[model samples]
Target: MNPTRSTFGLIFFTKKANENGECRIYSRITINGKSVDLSTKRIVDKILWNSAKGMARGTSKESLEVNDYLEQFRSGVVDAYQEAIIQQKPLTPENIRNAFLGQDEAAHPFQDLFNYHNEHEKQVLAKGTMKNYYTTQDYILQFLKKSKKPAEWDISQLSYKFIADFELFLRTFKKKDDPQPLNNNGVMKHLERFKKMINMAVTIEWLDKDPFVKHKLKFNSKERGYLSEEELALVETKELKTDKLMYVRDLFLFGCYTGLSYIDAINLTANNLMIGIDKEHWLITQRQKSAKPVKLPLLPVAAELITKHRHDPRAISNGTIFRPISNQKLNDYLKDLARECGIDKNFSFHLARHTFATTVTLANGVPIETVSKMLGHTKISTTQIYAKVVERKVSEDMQALRSKLSRKTVPDGEMIILK
Candidate 1:
């Protein structure tokens, strides 16, 4: 539509003529007064070219061939311009040139888009999150190689079938370093990352249709395990031989009271401690994982641990409340601490956060809404996973009601009614 508004012509750049006096050919494309010159990779004698007709002057054999090529090139550019308009792509001279050269901007490769999304997300996402995306990317590359597909595939090639096949690959594929395949939720995470990258492509107009539109992500909800109150108390009071075990125990107990994850716990600083509305010292900081603000009032045990480490040389130098330890070392020491304390459960640093949410907060009658807010959860449903009511708490509550009822009830003459 509106043919005169856009123009295409073949031109010879005689100013850059070679020593043999041959001028290079170029295709000029103009759209809405913006223009781009694309090389035709052809050369012609300037004397034989017609500036007015934008072609060769003579009908000689060489001239005929050059003229035919120019006609075809011009027609191709016109077709590319019309096709771009039909596809609702941006009407620019560079885009038309790209279309003419068979390089459509919409056809971005999946790997390229995935890398770009990860690079930009690093600013906002935590290190652990960025590592997860890297793992997902590696898995995708391995999947492509095993499936005998190209390393780089067009994003448009993604489909529901492609997603299903990827999930199957993740479930069945075994790595050389780790023979165990990914479980259901592990596979789901990679697929979710893939879908997110595709969604970004759609937002940037690189994809016309979302392949994940028909695919539904399903994940199994497994109960998150946390240390019970008795086990946590056992760990807290258990004396250990080495100073390292003692340090790990202190870190674990602090998490049990504050509900801070491993990363947040290590990064905590004196600056994060502030007086809240209750006139109590609180840990006010943003969670590394979700970047949500958390306002947790420091319980006695957590505050005591902070005070104990306040004058530590490493803590003082780092300006953090606790000296940072390697996560692997922390977990390893936690295992030792757990066994020495006679707790049979598989122990990890994250369990301490679960303990805080379940045994320390929710079990003590803290409202779920308040727990969710202090845990820095964007949704209450996330808090519910950690706040599951343990059977002991239920029994204790029901036993209290039983005792109260038995004390208030009286035996009547005909019926033993309670008041």
Candidate 2:
């Protein structure tokens, strides 16, 4: 620690064993009593250190001010030493929440979010989710820097208008590398990430309330156009004829018939297919999006495709039904299939799942609830989005009901019109 510095240290002791090792090491740093790092200390100390140096070089009545600067420097040194003596590990969410319970009501929500995310990234969230959290934090920090505000400013000062304006900023904002503005969905996603971070803050008792409570997240409904039966047949014909691209197309189309997502489909193997309880039907027991195992009856078309690929070399070695292919590459191949099929709309891996829902199941009079279960949707509402595609079937159902309800001159006039 330097007497001219404006920083403190944060050290924690952890037990370690070696041939001749039992000593404490300075693990981290802080300012006052809050967490900081060595880089942050250098940043905070540079100006004050320069000012003290300038005062020391002066030649006037303010010569004694050098002593004052020296005392300030001494205070910083003492704080750093005391901090090291009392330092512990990086603060956890529970530690932060308990701290909040006793502190004055002026702490910044953003700091709370940062602290909570730090702990959660190491302990709870999946690796992919943690990476996204860091991305969201970066976006927010960049926006705040552009606004010329302190990084640790009070979040209570934030308003719904501020959040809305930040979203607008993201849309109109452009980097030198990308001159085009961010799209609506992109901006909404970043803002929603911020909201989720805030929600986490509230969950950890870091904030009294969530500032985003008043804001509604708006996202455009995506139009997922699956292939028609005719289009699917055309693809199948072209795929079965092609050698280089046949396997990819087959696996993708198999997914189309079975309503399997690309990830779940790729991970499926012979082991997943087994005899049902009745032993009359084969079943595919697989985990879908929510990690819930669902048992779907093996349809003939799906079964045939599986049988065809049963002898593939990769399947033999890896014991998985399909060779591993990246989702991006799989989607790229689907674009080729769409081009060959003369279909105009863009298609992707997920379209296979949508195709099974709209074309194979709902179009053939299967109940939406049954389709929802086969699709492994945790909620029926998620599957109901396909109802738009099943409008014709619903119309036919309504017409049939109307005809069945139409009475032919009942015994009493007006068919006794039940109350």
What's the lDDT for residue 224 in model 1? Answer: 83
Q: Model 1 — TM-score against the truth?
A: 0.73
What Cα-based lDDT does every candidate model obtain?
A: 0.82, 0.65
Strongest candidate by TM-score: 1
Q: How many residue pairs clash in model 2?
A: 0
RMSD of each: 14.6, 15.3
Report residue 65 deviation for candidate 1 (angstroms): 38
lDDT of 2 by residue, 203-288 (tens): 55455446697898788777767877787787777734565467667876887788887877887877888888867445466554
Off by over 4 Å in 1: 1-101, 399-419
Off by over 4 Å in 2: 1-134, 150-158, 175-180, 239-244, 278-288, 391-395, 398-419
